[model samples]
Structure formats: C-alpha cells, structure tokens
Target: MNQEIQEYNESQTTDIKDVCNRLAQIIDGNLPEAESKIWHRHPVWFLDGNPTVGYSIQKPGVRLMFWSGADFEENGLNVVGKKFKDASIFFQHVSEIHQEDLVRWLNKSKIIQWDYKNIVKRKGELVRLKKS
Candidate 1:
C-alpha cells in the first residue's frame, strides 16, 4: 500500500480500519499491475492511469467503488453512479467482504474500464476504454 493510503487506513475506526486493510490487501494482491494511491481523499487503484477500483469512508459505511462497474452486469455492485459509469457496494464489517466476489469484481474492473483519466479532456464525457 502507498504510505498515505496506509495512513488513511490506519486513521479509520476499528471496524472500518479492518475493512479498509482487508480491501487494500485484496486489491493489491489481485491488481498487482495497478497503481494505488489516495485519490479524492480515499484509497484508489488505477490501471494505466485510469481509476479502476477504490474505497472511501462514507456515512453509509466503507464504500467499495468500481469506476466502470455500472456495466459489469453484476447485481452485487448495485449502487450505480448517476453521472458516471461507476458502481459500488457498502461494507460496514470486514466479514461482509466475500473474497470470491471481490476477486471477481477486481477481474471485471480490469476488463471493464471507463476513460476517467481523460474525462477532463473529453469535457465530462466518458468513453469506454475496455469491455467485457
């Protein structure tokens, strides 16, 4: 994990901390090629500079978000973003994280991606960079 991301995980309360640590470990293990850092004040992993997966401490809980997950077609990633191609699921406890599901989502994240890296250049329009 990145230094700042480590601190971010450490800064969370106990339950949330466990969830963050577990999430970080799983993401690192699965997406070894992805770059991880604290983006928008949360831990986010990127593939080829495009944001892929990330998590943040939200009022609801720890939100695991996939930038292109709206098209992943998986029912578990049900919290879809209205303005972007993002999708998410909340986890208040580390136990809620199913390794198989997480790995599956991570795999899908690699194959399904939105061009958030150039959203500024495209003037808020999103383009698909990968597909299932």
Candidate 2:
C-alpha cells in the first residue's frame, strides 16, 4: 500500500475518505492484482504500467479521474484536460458515489491505452486539418 494514499485518505473527512476507500476497493476488486502508485500526489490505479484511474482530495470533495473517459458513449464526466483523454467525476459524500457506474468505468478504462502527448499531437493535427 502506498503511504501517500493512506496519508491522503487520513487527512480527509470520514465521508470523503469513505469515497476514496470505496473507489480504491472497486478498482482493486475489478482488476487482476492492480498496482497502486502515487502520481501527482494522488492515488492512481494502473494496469499493465498504464494509468487507469486516480483519485484525489480536492476542495470540492474527492475527485475521481479516468484515463479513457472520452471513450464512453455519453460525455457525463467533466473533461479534465484538453490535451488528454481523461475525465473527472466529483463526489462530495459517500452516498453520492455510484458504485455500479464506477465499476463499469474502471472495467472499461483498464483496457484502453492513453498516450497523452500523442493524443494532444493528434488533436492538434485534427485542428489544423479543419482550418485547412
């Protein structure tokens, strides 16, 4: 277990911590011995050396980010960055966490390969194509 994540969870309120714990558990349970790491001070779940999901304690609450969020059919998640395919979902309370949806997201996200720089380059190419 990463001490950074433990410390991060410990610093949060009970509700916020619960949401974090549940998200961690969901990812761990779904994946085959998932590897956990602290990236950018946030707890990240990885699959085959690729980042699948991550969670952090933001002022608004626990912010959950998924790497393959753009692959989803509906754009319900807030776009995390224009340069990457990641998306974010905010949870202020444990009760607000939708376990089923999260499970689905993690399951789907684990298989997608995300290359942030390449994605950004490709996006820029598409923009250039459109202007021309």
Reference-based TM-score of each model: 0.95, 0.77
Mind sharing the TM-score for model 2? Answer: 0.77
Best of the candidates, lDDT: 1
Clashes of each: 0, 0
At residue 107, give the lDDT of candidate 1.
94
lDDT of each: 0.92, 0.71
Query: Which regions of candidate 2 fall more than 4 Å away from where they truly are?
Result: 1-3, 116-132
Candidate 1 lDDT over 29-111, as tens digits, reads 99999999998888999999999999999999999999899988989987545889888999999999999999999998989
Candidate 2: deviation at residue 22, Å? 1.3
Candidate whose TM-score is highest = 1
**Candidate 2 overall lDDT versus native:** 0.71
Worst 10 residues of 2 by lDDT: 123-132
Over the stretch 1-132, how does candidate 2's per-residue lDDT look in tens digits?
467777777777889888887777777777756788788788987765557788888788888888767655445578756665778889988888777887777766755546542445566432211111
